[model samples]
Target: MITRILLAVDDSPAAMASARHAIELAACLGARLHVVTVVPDHSLSNLVTRMGSHPGVHERRDQAAEAILDHVVRLARASEVEADAHLLEGDAARRILAEARSMHADLIVVGRSEGLDRSTTAHILEFAGQPVLVVPPEVR
Candidate 1:
């Protein structure tokens, strides 16, 4: 009954692992995949610009987010699963949850990076009504 899957990814090794898992799960379940990447809020970017500290920071982040989405989407399509990409701006956890609800996803998938704080994943688990699958970093 899990026909729609929402995958939140970043440019991290763990996220790549999660992308692979998501692709496999989608293919097995015949589910449509929705891939999403979030950038920092526009207001924060503006503040940084105003401070004259990091010009083009937002642009770089956007480009990186696009690349991440493109890579994941391509992988999903190669597995013959229908996939859509979303580039969102704002809080990562909130945006992901909203997208899940917007797409009516049956499940959510995310990656837990090694040594990184788990606040984002924790928030998602605390609020997401649907089941969530957390993929750990691939051990080499």
Candidate 2:
């Protein structure tokens, strides 16, 4: 009964693994995939300015987010699953949860990294109204 699946991803290996799982699941369930990656909101830091690395930081982050989303979307399409890409900026967990709610997703999928005290997957699980699948890196 999972017609819509929202997948939150990043550049981590775990995220890529989760993407693969999501693609397969969507294909099996005849579901559409909503793929999203967040560009973290960065606060101005004196160190960054002093180091002359602040100028392209936002651009680079945005590009990276786009790349991640694009990769996932391509994978989903190659698997014959319909996919949409969303590039968001702000707190990762908050944005992801908001996107899921906006899309009325039937399920949420995210990757969990081992040994992290607090993770986006944890936050999404704590707040998501729908079922969430947490894929570990070793799954694939």
Q: Identify the leading candidate in terms of lDDT.
A: 1
Q: Write the per-residue lDDT of candidate 2 for residues 15-104, one digit (tens) a residue.
A: 999999999999999999999987766664334666885667666777888989999999999999999998887888899899999999
TM-score, candidate number 2: 0.90
Candidate 2's C-alpha runs over 4 A off are: 44-54, 115-117
Let me know the TM-score candidate 1 reaches against the reference structure: 0.92
On residues 93-121, what C-alpha lDDT tens digit does candidate 1 reach at each position?
A: 99999999988999999999655438999
lDDT (0-100) at residue 41 of candidate 1? 82
Q: How displaced is residue 118 in candidate 2, in Å?
A: 3.7
Superposed on all Cα atoms, the candidates' RMSDs to the truth, in angstroms, are 1.6, 2.1
What's the lDDT for residue 34 in model 1? 95
lDDT of 2 at 85: 96
Candidate 1 residue 60 Cα shift, in angstroms, is 2.0
